[model samples]
Structure formats: C-alpha cells, structure tokens
Target: MKKIGILTINDYNNYGNRLQNYAAQEVLKSLGYHVETVINNTDFNKKNNKSTISNNKIQKIKKITPQKILKKVALLLRNNYFYNKRLETFRNQRIKVFKEFTSSYIIETDISITESNIPNEIVDRYDYFVTGSDQVWNPNYRKGSPIDFLTFAPKNKRIAFAPSFGVSEIPKEYHQNYKKWLTEMHGLSVREEAGAKIIKNLTGRNATVLIDPTLMLTKEKWLSISKLPLNKPKGKYLLTYFLGDISRERKKYIKEIAENNDLQIVNLLQIKEKFAYMAGPDELIDYISTASILCTDSFHGAVFSILLETPFIIYDRENQSSTHSMNSRIDTLLSTFRLESRLAKNIKNNKEIFEVDFSHVQAILDEERRKTYGYLKAVLNI
Candidate 1:
C-alpha cells in the first residue's frame, strides 16, 4: 500500500478536533493507504505545563492597575515579535514515534506545525500529504500566513480535505494568498459553502463543497469506537451546546419550549450527565442519538443532530454577527435542507413549537462525501 501523511489539529482532549483527525485517518485507511499523521506541538509546552497560567494569576491580572495592564500589553507585543521569527524553522524539525494501534503504527511530528521539531528522517517522507478537517486553513492558525503547509513541501502530491477557512468571508490580502495555495494543491474540498464561494471569488476555481469531517462516517461506525457515558440518565432531557452572546436568549427560549413540552434539559456540562467533560467523537454521537431535541450554535452540533435524525432548532447565538450575517453558512444549510421553516418559526416566536426533518440534509451530506472521496481517490491514484 502507498504511504500517506495527514495533517490536522489533533488535541487528545478536544473531541471535535480529535474526531476530525481520526476521521481523516480512517478515510485514508478506507482508500487502502498506509497512513501516518504529522502533528505540530507548538502548544505542547502550554498543554504539558499546567502552571503556565493560573486562575489566581488570571484573577490578579483582572484586578491589576491600568499601568500594569499597559505593561502587560507591551510585553505581549515583544514576545510575539520574537516568537514569529522562530516559528517556521522550529516547525520544519520533527520527531518520529511508533505507536501501537492494533499493530505497530507510526505518527510523525508534533501537534502545532509552527513549532514542531520533526526529525530529518521523517521530514520529506510520504507519497502525499493532506491538511485539514478543522480550520487547518484558518489564517489565525499560522499567524495570518499560509506558510505552514508550504514550508513542509510534501513531495508526490498534496490535498486539503474538508478544510475550512473558518470564517464567513476572507480578507483581501489572505484572499490572494489562498489563490496561490489552491493553484498548488492537487485536490481540495471545503467543509462550508461560504468558504467555497470565498475560494471561487479569490481564485475563480470551482472548489467542491463537502461535509464536516464528522459526517464522513456513520453514527454506527462512531459508536463502535466511542467512549460510553459514565452512566445514562434515567430521565428524558434536551441536549444543546452553549454558545456566546445570543445564547442566553436562545437558552431561555429553548428552556421555555422544553418546559412547555415537559422535557428536562440535559445540560452536558452539568453534573449527573453522561458525557460531563470534553467529550469524544463517539460520545457526542451517542448523546445526540439519545437527545429528544438539540439546540446548538456549533456546526458539528447541528450536523450530529441531523445525523441522529433528532429534532432540533438552529439557534443563532453567535455575537460575532447580527441576524443578517450570523452564521450564514448555517443558514444556508438549514435553508438547503428545508429547515428554513423551522428557523423562521423558532425565531418568529421561540414559544412556537416546531419539528425539523433532516433526511434531506443527511442525503446531501452523503452525496458530498461521495464526491469528496472520489476526489481524494483520484489524487491518491487509488
């Protein structure tokens, strides 16, 4: 089998990022390739060193004098300037590991590409490379530059699967840079249609829109590998993700709706819930499957709600935008799947009861994945 390298954000604790990374790895295995992951560990020191920032220190900073705050800002600017100078070179170095996954398997590099110290032996090895799943292309990731992937220079081929620019719109300077990257890529698929349009506007290329990494696998497949709830709650409850800003209003609205329905809220973060902490992919899928109704702000949260065929409302709670600009990508998905009525009905009156049918969106996701897989296979010459 051919060897392939997959690059994505892989934090062991963050379920969403982990699921996407695992899904990318599984997809490559399905295509009959021997896959290995190249991770960057820029945040390793922070993740490993728990003492870097303390709650006490944060509280103290919060209460510090204005002069101290100004001094802190000055220090931050100096630190950032020095950090950027070491980023690219630091990322080019790497380390190799032979992990046991049923059998012996190898994973090369750390989690943060910008600060990775990959060994020379693993630097230029691999038939092709993939960068993506969760906002790998987000400009914020590489300090407003696309140099992270470019610096690797993977030989043979390169692809970006279900990658996201992670924003509704692209800025002008980055827009030009994106076009350059697209021209070099052998294959590309974006998770959101808004991103696809942004690419087209910037590059005039008909980039394929695809499903989130979570939808690439079935609920059954996820359950097989997922961590089970510590204990299943005996009572019925609603599941929802907490978002900022409008969340308070949306939460109030949804709670009222649930109360009227006589169902309890199974606040995932609260005690007595099955998946209490940072949940994994399978745990999330199982929770969605069991939820009576889901209210959420996250795209994957919405995706799982549909995947489970559970009724849900797409509560727009992101303070980042007003009703007009708020998660238009989400609006697009809801409208495309005939959930516009539900959105309108929910917003028209949060008290108004409604149900959503996700069969159409699920089908669309499947079709998109089929096309995405086809493109991937073509790039890998499978």
Candidate 2:
C-alpha cells in the first residue's frame, strides 16, 4: 500500500475545511492506500488565541475613542489574563484529546501541527504529499506567500489537490514566486477553473479543475458520521452564509425576498450557543439539507448549496482593481454550472438578487458530480 501524507486545514470549525479533509481521507482509503492526516503538535491556544475577537477589525475600530481607550485597555488586560487561562485549559483539554484522537486512529503518517514540525526525514518517508483542501495557498494562511509551505518539504513528491489561491488576482511579485514553486509539483488540481487559469498563466501547465474534496463523498457517507438535527420543519427556507456581518439594507432585502417562502435563513456567522464563529460540519449539513434556497458570501456555502441541490445566490466580494481577480474562480464555477443569475455581482446593493432560478443549475450539478467521480477514479486509478 502506498503511504500518503495528507496536509490540510482541520483546526478551525470551517465546514469546507473538515469536508475536504474527510473527502481526501475517504477517497484515499477507498483506493486501498495506507493514509493518515499529518497532524501538527502545534498549540492553537497559545499565549495569543488565533481566533480571538481582539485581533479582528472591530477591536481596531474601538482603538481611537477616549471612552473606548479605557475599555480597550481593560479589554487587553482582561483578554491577556483570560487568554492565558484559556490557553492552559485548552491545552489540557483539547490538545490532549487531539493527541488521543491521533493515536486512536490507524495513522501511518506522522502529524505535524506547524510547518516547523514537518521534519526533513518525515518528508522523505512519505510516498506522496497532498497539500490543500481549501484556500491553503492563500497568502493570509501562508504568512503572505502561499508557497511558503513548499519550502518546508524538499524530498517528498508534492501535489496540490483542489487547492485555491484564495481570490483571483495575485500580485506580479507573488507570480514569480508561484512559478518557481508550482513547477516542482507532480499534479495540480484547483477547486475553481479561474484558479486553473491563474496557475496556467504562471506555469504554462493546464491545471485539472476538480470538485471541492467534499463532493467526492456522497451525502450518505456524510450523514452516517455527521451530526444532523432531528425533526426539521417541513417548509422552504433560505440558507444565508453571512459570517462577515451583512449590512442592514441587505438583511432587509433578504427578508423581503423570503416574505412568503418560510425562509430558513441560517446565518453561519451568527454566534451560536458556544459563541464560536459558526457551526461545524454536522451542523452545516443539517442546515444545508433543509434549506430550499441559499444566499451566501462564503465559497463553501455556495459549494454545499450546489451539492445539496439547493438554489443559491452568491455574494462575491467586489474587486476594485484589475490586480484583484479573486472572484473569477467563483465566477467560473457559477458560469460553468449556468448559475450566473444566482451570483450577486454587487454584494451590498444588488437590485437583481431576487431573480435567481435554481432548477437548471441543480441538473448541472448532477452532471458535474458524475464528472467529479470520473476525475476521482482517474486520480486514484481505481
């Protein structure tokens, strides 16, 4: 059996991240390979919590006010102390659980939490290294350079499976950096076609556009292990993926659109009972399964909507510069599936947002799933 090391984002509660990890694991296991997700021993809840609200823009806005100054100081001091205590508790509880989870699983591959944990010897040990499930190549994740992960593993045969460079346009400076690293890859597949174009432009290689890893697994497989709620209301509802706080005007428009439809408006970003950013894979699946329609700003939100045969309206971010071409990846998917009407060109002031029809696009996704299976078969040589 070929030993494979799967590298991906699984620390966060992002549904796309978990689904992608599960998809790759499922596909590899079905192909009869010995596989394990390389987990890092890195501490997520260190002295500074990565997901803390203080690091966010809201805290930055409160920095300049006199009253907010005292509040900020108090918040910082409290946050520091609270953060330290949470770090210890989190380390004791979560990290211990992670270690136990890793050990319990039949993991042949060594898991490294941080890029630093990936040793030179471990790289040489694995036959193939699969890097990516979501926006792993995004500069934000890679500390300003998406290809920084490549610098860590020199000996292993590397491949990027359904990797996204995040948004559309990469700067000319990063383009040169991408050219050097991407040339070394064995196989390149991107989640979006526009991302393929970007990669092709840089490497002169036609990247195989694959479905998001989550699509590789059927709903049955997901349902078996996923945490789904019982007794969903038997009515039509819209799945709203507004993690980034939509304006009141947009919220009003959505309500107007759902006036008669019994819309099940699910704000994935809304603070849950636990005060986390959003629900995990199980919670998201339940939300997606019941939603008759979806209005989303998240890439994965749109993805799940399509997979579940739900009609969707995507609110892609506005690109102000020619250099900012991130939405093309999403645009390619929307256009290919003939769901251009469902894509909101203007996130905030979309006058025609209510005009999306889901029937034709639902059929298109069915056809795409067949193609997705074929791609998987080819990749796995099944």
Candidate 3:
C-alpha cells in the first residue's frame, strides 16, 4: 500500500478538528493508502521557542504538582481564581474526551513533527502529503504554517484538499508567502468559494471548492461510530454549541425555540454543564444526530446538522464584520445546500426557524462526495 501523511491543525480540543482528521484518514485509507496524521508538536519545542510567562503561573504546569490543589491554596485567594480553576478543569476533561477519539479512530506518526525537527528521513516515507479538510490555511489559526502546505515535501507530492483560509480574504501580511507556498503545490482545493477566489487572485489559478471531509461520509457512517452519552436525555432536547460568546438575545431566542419545540435545552460548550462539556466526539455525533434542533455558530456544527438531517439554526458570530471573522465559510456551506434560510439573521418567529426543508440535501451531498473523491484520486494520481 502507498503511504500518505496528513498535515492538519494540531489541535485536540475541538470536535470539528478531530472529526476532520479521522474523516481524512478514513477516506485516504479507503483509497488504498497507509495513512498517518502528522502531529505538529509546536508545544514540545520548548528549548528554543519558549512561551512567554503570563501572570497566572499555574497555566504552564501540566503534570503532578499541577494536580495538587490543596497545596496551592494561596493562589486560590486571587481574584477570579475560581473562574480560572473552572476553565482549567474543563480543558482537562474535554481533552480527555477528544483523546479517546484520536486513540481509537486515527493513526498518528510516532514522532511528533515540529519546525525544528521535520524528521528528514520520513520525507520519502510518504508517497504523498495532504493538508486538510480543515482551516490549515487560515493564517489567524495556523499563522501561515508552512507545515500545512507540506513545504517539507517535494513540490510534486503536495496536495491540498478542502483546506480553508477561514476568512474571506487573505491578509496582506501573508499574501507573498501564501502565493509562493500555494503555487508550489501539485494540487489545490478549498472548502469555501472565498478561498478559491483568494487563490485565483494570488496564483492566477483556479482551485476547486469542495465540501468538508466530514460531509463526505454518509450519516450511517457517522452513526455507526457514534456512542451515546451516558447522560443523554430520555426525551427530546435542543442542543446549543458555540465557539464564541453567544448574545443574551440569542439565548432568549433559543429558550423560546425550545419551549415551542417542547424540548429540553442542553448547552454542550458551557463549562458549568459538566456532563455535556465532557462529551466525546462520538457522543457529540449522537447529541447533534438526536437533537430536536441544534443552535450553533460553528462551521462543523452546521456541517454535522445537515448530514444528520436535523433542524438547525446557524448564528452569525459577534465578530462577523471583522477581517478575522469565520462567517464566510458558514455562508458558503448554507448557500451550497440552499439552506440559507436556516441562518438566523432576521427570523422573529420561532416556528419560522424550524420550517427548514432538507429533502434536496442528500442528492447534493452525494454529488459533493463524488467530486471530493475525484479530486483526491486525481491529486494522488491513482
């Protein structure tokens, strides 16, 4: 079998990131490639790239002394100490949840890849190198990570599949490097039309816009691996997942929707919601799959909702007008499915929000999957 190494966002705390990593691996595996995700250990290269110290000293430690709470009672007396402690606990639990999915579903390189240590010997090990169905190209996210573009690999071996810039426009700061790095790739594709447009302007070459890898798999495939959260409600419930702070008005609207749908509300990202906050990727699939309605501002939340054929409302982030806003990707996703009506901008009535039609989604998904497969096959030269 041919060997392929996937370089994506080296994040484990996100549901979408982990899911996309697995999706890319499985899709590549199905195509007869021995796949492993390249782990970017930027955090591990502490000798040369040491992180600056913040006022909160406890944030740096991640080992034995970090767990001893009573011994550090003095720090607890500081302002907002309890709040910081709550956040630390949430991070620990959620990472554990995400780690389970990575361990079971994805194969990773034994040696973590970092800028200083590329493991030069492994450059020839992979027949091809792919960079992602996630926002690996997003400068704000990866800070123009050359690793994402497979800069370490030979030009003929680089392939970009459904990678996102996360914003509508590439910042001026990244333009020069972005152009050179992208121009060198053997194949290029993006998740949103904006990214394709950006590429066209930069390299004067058109990039195919494809659906995210998460949507490439059928709902049945997702359900087969989904595990039920032990504390899932016996009855119907509305699920709320937001990466940014949700407005009070949105919360009121969510409550009204839940009341109208006769469903209990479950806030998955709320740190105080212990059970829901600790939900694994498999449990997250079930949560979204089984939701009466999902109200979220995340791109993947919208992706999964459509795949599961569930009713959902996509919210515009508070930073929608900012250059760093991620609204464009969600805009593209909704537009592609003709579900632009699902985006909550001016709908005042709760009934109008749930009046979504998904009858035509499957056909679209099938075609996008076909296109994704074709692109991957062509890029891999199969």
Q: Which lDDT value does model 3 have at 134?
A: 88
- Candidate 1, residue 87: the lDDT equals 47
Which candidate has the top score in TM-score? Answer: 3
Candidate 1 residue-wise lDDT, 110-180, digit = tens:
43354455556554566787877677666544444443344456534667787876677655666666777
Tell me the spans in candidate 3 whose CA falls farther than 4 Å from its real position.
Answer: 44-77, 346-348
Across 1-382, the per-residue lDDT of candidate 2 in tens digits comes to 7777787665544556666676777776776777777765444345233664444546675656876787776777787787678656544543343344334432534335464455657766666677776776765345333333454565336667778877676666567778877777765778887678878888898888877767666667656655553444457666677545577777887887677565655555554322212344665676776676677777777767666666567875542344454566677677766776676544333335444455675466567667755665565455
Residue 61 displacement in candidate 3 (angstroms): 27
Worst 10 residues of 1 by lDDT: 93-102
lDDT of 3 by residue, 1-382 (tens): 8999999886778999999999988898989999999888765334335444444555533332745765554554553577777888889878987987899999998877877788977798889999998888877667777888889999999999799999888889889999999999999999998889999999999999998999888899999999999789999999999998888888997898888879899998898788999999999999999998899999999999999988898888774557788988898999999998887874667776767789999999888889989999898888
Please report the candidate that would top lDDT against the real structure: 3
Q: Backbone collision count in every prediction?
A: 14, 12, 0
lDDT of 2: 0.63
**Model 2 per-residue lDDT at 331:** 73
- Model 3 Cα shift for residue 32 (angstroms): 1.2
